[model samples]
Target: MLVIRGLGSQYGRISVLRSVNLVIGRHQLIALVGANGAGKTTLLRTISGVQKASSGQIEFDGKDITQLRADKRVKIGICHAPEGRHVFGPLSVEDNLHLGAYSRADKAEIAADLERNYAMFPVLKQKARLPAGTLSGGQQQMLAIARALMGRPRLLLLDEPSMGLAPLLVEEIFNAVTELRKRKITILLVEQNANAALAIADQAYVMETGEIVLSGSGKELLGNERVREAYLGI
Candidate 1:
């Protein structure tokens, strides 16, 4: 469903992503795992059109979106749940979700999707009237994911969904991600928790110094010697 070839990006003169190539099939969950400075987040930002690529191309469903603006990318069904769970602090929970569908004109479908998100994250429904900043970190992450779902995205870009949550809450978040895949929502997850991420992904990629060093099925990477030593610490 998505193809990236020779993609490169930089901040001023310093390069962050270097010739990164990847392909994601429909209905698949792909994980990208790497250390803190490996440029994983930069790749996702570039793909989502928030950060411009210095070189190479990005195609979604066979059409080039490299030059498209971020809002235009949203209209084409690309939604990103950023690493920090940057929910609108002053907005009510419901209003925050409603903002996700800002590009769409279908009220009925949007309402239906809103209910679907509430079903997925019941706490969000419970906090419907509260300010988003009042929620706990885990709840805020759920709110972020649910808000992205409100956009009815075809391919969801998740950046560190489990970053600051407790272990049990991390499990809950991963389970929710699995459910999204069961619903056939394609995902490209950038995670620091290699074990948890690979355990749920269908395919996984290892990134080092802004380049893809290895790619394989999730199970394969989980058992890989280098992966275990470096990322998994096993």
Candidate 2:
């Protein structure tokens, strides 16, 4: 559904991503795992059109979108749930979710999707009128993902969804991700938790110093000696 070829990005003269190539087939969950500075988030930002590519190509369903604006990309079915659950602090939970579908005019579908999101995160329904900032970290993350789903994204980009949550919350978030993939939402998950990410991914890529070092089936990378020693701490 998406293809990135020889993609590169930089912050002024400092290069952050170099020749990054990846593909996400329809209905697949692809994980990008690396250390803190490995540029996984940069790659996602570039693909989502928030970070401009210094070089290379980004194609979605056969059309080039390398130069498309961020909002345009979202309208084209690319939605990003950023690292920090940057929910609108003063907005009610329901209001925050409604903003996700601001690009669409289909009120009936939007209402149905809102209910779907509420069903996915029952706490959201309970806190429908509460300020987003009042929710716990885990609940905020749930709201973030739920908000993105409100866009009816064809390709969801998730960066560090489990970042600071408790173990149980992390499990809940990951399980929700798995369910999304099962429902055939194509996802590109950028995670620091290598073992957990690889465990759930249909495919996985290992990145180092702004370059992808290895690509394989998730289980294959999970059992790899180098991956075990470096990322998994095995």
lDDT per residue for candidate 2 within 85-179, as digits (tens), equals: 89999999999999999899999999999998888889999999999999999999999999999999999999999999999999999989999
lDDT of 1 by residue, 1-234 (tens): 999999999999999999999999999999999999999999999998999999999999999999999999998899999999999999999999999999999999999999999898899999999999999999999999998888889999999999989999999999999999999999999999999999989999999999999999999999999999999999
User: For every model shown, what is its TM-score relative to the native structure?
Assistant: 0.99, 0.99
lDDT of each: 0.95, 0.95
Displacement of residue 123 (Cα, Å) in model 1 is: 0.7
> Model 2 clash pairs?
none
Quote the lDDT for 79 in model 1.
97
What's the lDDT for residue 151 in model 2?
90
Candidate 2 ranges beyond 4 A from true positions: none
